[model samples]
Target chain A: MAVYTEVPDSALSAFLDAYDLGTLLSYKGIAEGVENTNFFLHTTAGNFILTLYEKRVNEADLPFFLNLMEHLARRGLACPQPVRNRQGEALGRLCGRPAVIVSFLDGVSVKVPGVDQCRALGQALAALHAAGRDFGMTRANSLSVSAWRPLFAQAEHQADSVSPGLAARTRADLDLLESAWPTGLPGGVIHADLFTDNVFFIGEDLSGLIDFYFACTDAFAYDLAICLNAWCFSPDGSFHRDRAAALIAGYEAVRPLEAAEVEALPILARGAALRFMLTRLVDWLNVPPGALVQPKDPREYDRRLTFHRQARDARDYGRA
Target chain B: MAVYTEVPDSALSAFLDAYDLGTLLSYKGIAEGVENTNFFLHTTAGNFILTLYEKRVNEADLPFFLNLMEHLARRGLACPQPVRNRQGEALGRLCGRPAVIVSFLDGVSVKVPGVDQCRALGQALAALHAAGRDFGMTRANSLSVSAWRPLFAQAEHQADSVSPGLAARTRADLDLLESAWPTGLPGGVIHADLFTDNVFFIGEDLSGLIDFYFACTDAFAYDLAICLNAWCFSPDGSFHRDRAAALIAGYEAVRPLEAAEVEALPILARGAALRFMLTRLVDWLNVPPGALVQPKDPREYDRRLTFHRQARDARDYGRA
Candidate 1:
C-alpha cells in the first residue's frame, strides 16, 4: 500500500482494546505498498494485521473487506480473519481513518511455486469461488470487457512509443475481445487477484490465502486466467505449458470450465491483460514524488497485453 | 480516474472561481483510473484537463506535479502546461483535494503506432530525460533494486503454487540483478511513465507528453529499459525485434547507452519486469470489492518477469 498516509500505532491499540485480544505487545507498519497503510501487529493473543483505510481505500467498503475475511475464514479458507471488537463490530475509527485488525495468517508466499502447489492453488481457488457462490455480498468486476477502450484511450497518444504496428494490433485485439466476450458462462465469486503474493503456503501444502480485497462476482474462468497469468509463467516470461496444464487440471477438477467459458478464454485473457496494462500504465503516469509509492513499469503489462493479443484459442494455453 | 471520487461539475466550477479560466462550456469526468479523478473540460479558452488529487495521490507533491508540467512546457517538450491562478499559484484546494488545471494537448493517441513512431517516441523520451536533467529535483527511485526481495518475500509462501523450478529461477535472477545493476549510469530527470497514454501526437509529428507525476532523478539507462519494454512488443505479447532496434536507435540518437548500461540491460529489464510483477501481484491480491477499479492479471507481468530472467546481450537489441 502507499506509505504517504500516516497511520498511528496508538490508533491500532485503541481498536485492540475493543477486540478482547489482550494487550497489544507491539505493532509495526509493513513497509511494502503504494496504496494502503498496513501494519503487522503482535500481541498476547496472536499475530494480526492492522490496516488503516488509506486514501485509495473507501471507508464504506470496510465492512465488505472485514466481513469477507470472516466469510472466507468460516468456509475453511486459510486466510486472515478480521477480528471484531467486544461490541461485535469489525469496523472502527483509527487515526481518524476507517481501520480493522485482522488475524495474521502464517505461511510464506513462494518465490517459485511448484506444479503441485499450482494445482493445489487451482483447486483451492475453485473451491473458494464455489463457496463464495452463495455469499449475500456481490461486487461487479470493475475491469470488465467494456472498460478496455476507455483505458487504452488514456495512453493512445504514446502508442508510437510502444512498437511498430502496436497501435493497429491493439485495435485488432480490442475488436477480437469485444466480438468474443462471453455471453453466458458460469458466473460466481472469484478471487480476482490470486497473484502469487496473495496466496500463502507451508512448503508444498496450500496453507491459506490472504488479501481477498479484489474478490467479486465475475466469470469463473476469468479467475482461472488470472491464476494462469500469476502462476503458469516462467521467470523469462515464457508460458510454461506444464505449469499451465497442472493449474487448469487442478481447477477443472473442482469447478470445470463450461464450453462457453473455454471459448471465451482467449478474449478473457486479452481483456484481463488489457485491464492490468491500463492500471499499471495509469499508476506509472500518476506516481507522486516522496509518497514512498513506486510507479509500476507499464511495459511489463504491455508485453502481457501483447501476449493475450496472440492467444487465438484455449488450446494456446496447452493441452488440458 | 475512478468515478466516485470525481469532483462534481458544479464543484469544479466553484473551484475554478479561485482561478480565471473564463466560462466553462463543458466538463465530463474521465473514469479510467484506480487513483486520481480526471475531467475533460472545455471552455471559451479551449480544452483542459482538470485533475483532482485522489487518495493515492499525496497532497504535498502537488507543487512538483504542477511545476514539472510548467517546466517541461517552458522547455518546449510539447507537455501540458499547468495553468496558474491570478495569484500565480499553480496549485489550489478543490473539494478538500489538491487540484490543477492543465492545458489540453491537441492530437490523437495513435491506435496502431508503427516502428517509425516507436523510434520517434524513443527519441522524444530521450529528449524529455535530457530536458529534465537540470530541473533541480531529487526523488530517489522508490521501486529501486532494494525493493525486489521484500516484495518477493510478501509472496514467497505460495512459491510452490508456481512451477517447481520458478523459485530457484527467480532467486538466481534476483542475484544476477543485484550483481549486474549498473551503479554509474548517467543520472537525470526522467518522465518515468512515458506510456503511450501519457503522450500526445498530431499525425507524424509529436504534440505533447502528459503525466509527469513519476518524473524523478534516475539512471538514464533504466529509463531506456522502461521505453524498450513499452515500445518493443507486439500487441500479441511477442517481442518485435525490429521495433526494439528502431526504438534503441531512436534513443541512442539523443543519448547513447554506455557500455556498462548496455551490459546491464538484461538485469535492468529483469528488475523492471520484477517491479511490475510484484506491484501487480500485490494489487491483484488487494483490490477492494465493489470499487470501480479493475484487478490486473498478475500472469501477464509474471510472463514479462520470466522473460527478463533469460540473460540477453545488448547485441540482441541490435545496433542503434
Candidate 2:
C-alpha cells in the first residue's frame, strides 16, 4: 500500500480552488501504488482520483504521466482521464507535492488471475502499447538493463543475507543482461510495471489500467515479459503454460510480436525478475524499524529468477 | 491515516460471496480510521465502506459499535448506516477479523475549523448523545477516568522524555482528577472521541459523524468537553473563545446542560486532555520501529492539560 504522504484538509481545499470541481465531499487516501499517494475523492461535481506524486516520481515527468492518461483516454482506451483545472492545466501542487486529479476508472483487479483474465489483461496491455505509441514524449525505463547494476550494488553486500550466493547470481545475471539485452525491437511507451494489480477488469472485460507511475519508453515485448513473470506465475513459482499462451495470444491479437521480440522473451523475463528482486531486496534490507509496510519478500523473485535461469527459449514459456 | 490490516483478494472475494451486492467492481484499501482496515468498496449494487476490526478494537464490543451506528442512523443521524447481509445480520467476518459493510456518507472534514463549523459539530454531537440515550446496549468508555492511570503508568517512566517536567506533573494531575472526579451527571452513549476528522460537513451543515469505535456510555457533558479540547484549540495550543462559545451554545440549543454538568466541565475537560495525553504518550514512547504513523505528540495534550488544570468553570471555555 503506497501512501507515504498525507494531504492536509487546508492544502486540499486550496488545491481544489484551482479547479472547477465543486466543494469536496469526501477524500480518502487509497492504499495503492508503491510510489505515490492516491486519494479516492468525491466532490459535489463527481467521483475522481486525486494523486499526489511523491519522492519517487520525477516532477519533470509530470506531463508525461498526465498526458499519457489523457492521450489513451481520449482515444477510447479504458484509462483515467486527467481532469484539467479552470486554467486548463492538469498539474497542480498539494501539500507541497505535485498533484493531479483524474477521472476514476471503474473496475476491480483479479488476485489469482485465471486464463481468461490473463487474456483480457494481455489485450488491454497491447491496446495500451498501441495507444501510447504516438504519445510524442518519452521517458527512459529507469529500471531497465543498464540500471540493474547500480541497484544491485546497493544491495550486493547484503544480498547473500537474503539467500546464500544470491548476490553473486544477481551480479552475473546483471552482467549478462547488460551485455546481451536485445535492442531495437519496437520501442515505445510501455506499461513497464503491468502487475495484475495494475490491470482492472469488470468480469471478462478489461475496464481499465492504472498506476502509470512506471510507464516509460521501453521495448514493448519487455512489457510482455514482465506480465509473464507477474501474471502467469503461480504463487508457488511454477510457470503456468496455458495461462502464458492465453496471455501472449491475446497480445498477438492486438499487436503481433516480431520474431526477434519472441526470441528475446527468456532473457527479458530473467532481467525483469532480477530487476524486481534487486529493488525488493534493497527495500527488505532497508526497511526502517517501525516501517508501516511489510516489505515484499525478495526471495519470491529469487525463486522466479531460479526458474528463468533454466529457460532457454520462448518455447519454454509456451509461445506458439 | 489508520489502516491496520490488509484484506487479501481471495479473502475479499470469499467475503463478498456472502453478500448480495451485485458484482464486486472495485475495492481499494482506503487510508481512513486508525483502528481498522477500511476499503472503499464499489460493486454492481453501490459504493460502501468495508471495515475489518483490528486488535485495538475488542471483538466482544463490536455489536455495540455496529448497532450504535444502526441506532443512530435509524434516528436520522447522518452516519454510515451499517449494511446487513441477506441473513439480517449487519455483522460478518473478513480476513479472520470481525467485519461489516456500512453505507457511505458524503461530506468532507475541515482542517482549521471555525466558529460556524464548530457550532455545527457541537449540535450534531449533542444530537448523537440524545439519540443514543436509550441505545439499550452499553459499552464502558475504556479510556474513562479510572483507566487513565494505568495508561499513564505504562508511559509515566518515559513521560519526562516528552517534556521537561511532564511525568511528575501528570502524576500530580491524576491524583487530583481521581479524587475529585464528579458523578451524578446525566450519562448516556457519548461520542467520546469527537475530533475534527470524525465529523464531516457540506458547507456549514454537519452531514455526518463517523468512527463509532470510541463510542461509549459516559457523561453527556464529557462529550462536549472532548469537543472543547479538540475543536477549540489552535495549533499553538491557544484556546479559541468564539469557536468554543459557538460549540457550547449549539449543544445547549439542543440538549441543555444541567448546572452540575456545567460545573463539572473543567474537570471533565482536564480528564479528556489526560485521557488523550496518556494514550498519545504511550504511543509516542512505544511506536514500533517502522510504524507507518507518527504518534501524535503527547505534548499537544500536555499543553491542553496545562490549560484545563487552571480553568475554574465552563465560562472559561466560552460557556456564557
**Number of the top TM-score candidate:** 2
Per-residue lDDT of B1-320 in model 2, one digit per residue for the tens? 65677676778888888879988888888876767789999998888999988888899898999899999999889999988888899889887888999998887888789899988888898889889877889888889889988898888887887898998899899999999999989999988888988888876678899898998898998999999999999756788889999999999999889999999999999998889888989988997755656678888888988788789888999999
Model 1 lDDT per residue over A64-168, tens place: 667777887888877888888888888877777777788866554665667898889889988898777777887777678788788778766666475555557
TM for chain B in all models?
0.91, 0.97
lDDT of 2 at B42: 91
Q: Looking at model 2 chain B, which ten-residue stretch has the lowest summed lDDT?
A: B1-10
List the DockQ of the predictions in order. Answer: 0.01, 0.60
Q: Write the per-residue lDDT of candidate 2 for residues A1-320, one digit (tens) a residue.
A: 75788777778888898999888888888877767888999987888999888777889988998899899988788888899999999998888888899998888787788999888888888988888877889998888888888888888898888899998898789888999899998879898888888888876788889888788999999999999999988666888899999999999999999989999999999999888888899999998665557788888888888899999999888888
CAPRI-style docking class of model 1 based on DockQ:
incorrect
TM-score of each model, in listed order: 0.49, 0.96
Residue runs of model 1 more than 4 Å from their true location after superposition: A162-166, A234-236, B1-320
Error of 1 at B152 (Å): 40
